[model samples]
Target chain A: MEAKLKYYLQIADNALILSHRLSEYCSKGPFLEEDLANTNVALDLIGLAESMYIEVARQENEGRTGDDIVYRRKETDFLNVILVEMPNDDFAHIMVRQFFTDVFHQQFFSELRNSKDEFLMGIAHKSIKEVLYHLKRSSEWMFRLGKGTVEAQEKAQVAINKYWKYTHEFFLENDTDSEMLKAGIGVDLSLIKKNWLAKVEEIFTMSNLTIPTNDFTIEGGKQGYHSENLGYILTEMQFLPSKYPDAIW
Target chain B: MNITALSKEELLVEFEAKINAEQKIEPLDWMPDEYRNHLIRQISQHAHSEIIGMQPEGNWITRAPSLRSKKILLAKIQDEAGHGLYLYSAAETLGVTREQYIQWLHEGKAKYSSVFNSPALNWADMGAIGWLVDGAAITNQVSLQKTSYGPYARAMVRICKEESFHQRQGYEIMWKMMEGTKDQQEMAQDALNRWWWPSLMMFGPHDSDSPRTGNAMRWKIKRETNDYLREKFINKTIPQAELIGLKIPDNNLVLLEDGTYKSGDINWDDFWKNVNGNGPCNEQRLAHHIKAHTEGAWVRESAFVSGFQK
Candidate 1:
């Protein structure tokens, strides 16, 4: 596969995987408004993912299609980060995970707008507008919970600690990403990492929270390997398409 | 008057002045305690309505006939939820915490819209809700954007922006049915028949009988009387029904001499019965709500453990 395709897959896979996770809250959120807001966000993510996949297939020029990349790809062939795949577990966990991912996504896309790759730059420009909204939303919750009550504060702290290790992988790039970076087809994730840290640190300070320092990082997602959660997700997401095998409505 | 009695009258006068001046009452503003109490009750009840409103439409999600239908239904339900959150937050601004408001609901102390207490019954109920229930809500909310309360009005503005498509989506569904098989058309009419009267009741009791109407109006909380709003909704929807080639539920629905449609009498007994927790799905709705809340405990716990709660 072309390095640009691989990079686009990572972007598409992040949206696809995270949106699937968020969609679990569709009927199940604690309140109705959140149910709608989360699902809207999920839909936006899925729509963005589809757009990215279309670009990838077009760029690859190897007889690939969006459906081929989406439904036909195996779990190991997907390249979403581990943080995007984690379960919500609760409102706080969801917020924490959303906060971290959004911070990285926002900064990554901000820089990717200047990418030498035209299609990638266009995608980044659009996706960044959405990522900015997501970051603001998650940051608002962070402030609300942190400043609201002792219980909220304690819970938010716990959620951050548990998800902290996954933050590192967002910046962990290998040879492929590096090659794309040199070609100006990929963003230097390191810049995104620095921006993410600063952004998160500021939110933490305002929320009266502390940042945890831990070096452990899970790196499998960028390599097409995933946690067990992906199995269940694919089963449900792909069930209808696979069964119909050319169904249209 | 003595100190206590004088203060009460003074508070009422101040509240009236603010309302007359068209100023929004914020959380920390000074006014009659009764005004605060009344708004808390009304706004929280509205909040509850949005939450419970999810059930009827939620029933049809997995069973939505087409992917487009499914997506639209999901989005509508989500919008309902978002409206609920905004209402809850708005209510919270009135000194009622989210937990307290929820407790009131679980204990049957707070009332949701009586309309939602009934079952969705069939797929057409989804259309009916969008066409009627949401239409009624929009009428009420459009007026409420001018309400005296700052947070509630501001939240309603945001909600109304997103809710623009809900009623249209429902109407679209009905239109589709109108163009589909005979069975589908009948299903649409049947849903409309069942849902029509209940939707009018969503505006609450007749103005004459309503206890809060005078004060709510004085406070700009209710911009129009229930009867008047009901008449407006009927006038607007009746033509829509005509365009869609579906009959309105009531044969008595007719244009008045002065260019308004007057609706038939609603079944108030049924409305009150549902309001009092005797509706078909009242228990089911509450049970599901409590179940979902409890089931998500571990997730909340994990969030707490992860410091995300902070």
Candidate 2:
């Protein structure tokens, strides 16, 4: 695939998969209003994904459509960082995961607003508008969970520990992203990652939560390797599209 | 001695002219203590209702039929929580803290809307909640926007603007299911039947039986009576039910001479029973809430420790 086409697909696939993960909280959130807010974020993510996929299809010349890109793609073809695809083991875990990803994506997309690529920049621009709210809401929860009580403090710390390993992969720059950044396609993930870490570290310190230092790190999400969670997510997400190849609903 | 006493009649020439003229009553404005208490009770209950209302619909997040549906539902639920927060803030303007209100709920002194106590059985229940429950709520909310309390009225105005989409999404679910297979249609109908009465009961007891109505109406807190909105709901919902190819659960639902659909007597006995904690899912619902509160204690503590830095 051409780099631009591949570039668009990476962004699109990440949003699509993560949105699927977020949407899982539809009826299962601790409260009704939180469910609604979370779901709105999910919709925004998916809508953003569709737009990116359309741009990707335009460049591919493979006769593929948005649906084809989203539903037809197998697990190895997906490119979302593993941080988003992780399970919502508990409400704290979910909030921490969302906080980590949203803060990172906010920086990434905010920089992409100035991209030389018109369509990619446009999508990123619109997406950052929606993402600001997610960042605000998720950041608030992280603060609350981290600072509220002893138990809440411990839970936040544990969530930070468990998910910290996956956070590194978000900034891992390969040829595709680096070349695009040079052409002003988007920001370099490595730079965005550095800023994301600094911001998150400040939050962690203030929240009275400790960041775990482990030499072991999970990689290869961008390179098509993912955790076991993505497979189940893919199974449920692809079921309808797989059954009816051209289904539009 | 039979009517007016001599001393009282001699002194009765002077009343507060502005209060008698129906001028806006500020918190510092002198009034009966009963009026303040009544406003507190009503507004606090309204605030509590918004908070607890999140349960039934929240139950369906894991099983939303589609990504679109899930997204819509989530947004709607978030609005409900925001509404609760807004109402709490409004109530605080009347001199109450949110912590006190939550404590009342924990101690079983505060009451939320009775409708939310029921379970959301399936995806269709999500449709029913949005369509009927939120439909009834909007009817009341639109009226409440004109309520006498300044802050409460403003909150209602904000809530009503965002509420328009909620009912439509719900009815859209029913529309899809009605056009879907037999099983789906039946699921929608079953949800409608089970939820119909509970939803109507949400407006509270009949006008004749409700003591708070006269005072609330006089104070402009409750813009309309229970019977009034219930009639409007029937008149509006009956046509909607026809469009969806479903029957209204009540058999005696018929158009009156004024073109209002007269519904049957609401079973207040069942209402009281449910209010007394014997509803089908009341225990289960509270249990879930308490568990979440307990389990998520650590997160709240951490948030405090973080000191709002993030």
| CA shift of B15, model 1, Å | 5.8
Residue lDDT tens for model 2, B170-217: 899888878876767887899999999998998888899898898677
- Residue-by-residue lDDT tens digits, candidate 1, B1-310: 6545457667677768887999888888776777888888988988888888877777665445443565677777777777788888888887779988888887888888888877887667888899889899998888888888899899989888766688898898888777776667777899998888888888888988898898778777888999889888888888999998988878777688998887788879998888888988889988877777765554454444545443
- Shift in Å, residue B130, candidate 1: 3.5
10 residues in a row with least lDDT, candidate 1 chain A: A240-249
DockQ values for all predictions? Answer: 0.14, 0.36
Best by TM-score: 2
Docking class of 2: acceptable
Error of 2 at A206 (Å): 6.7
TM-score of chain A of each: 0.95, 0.94
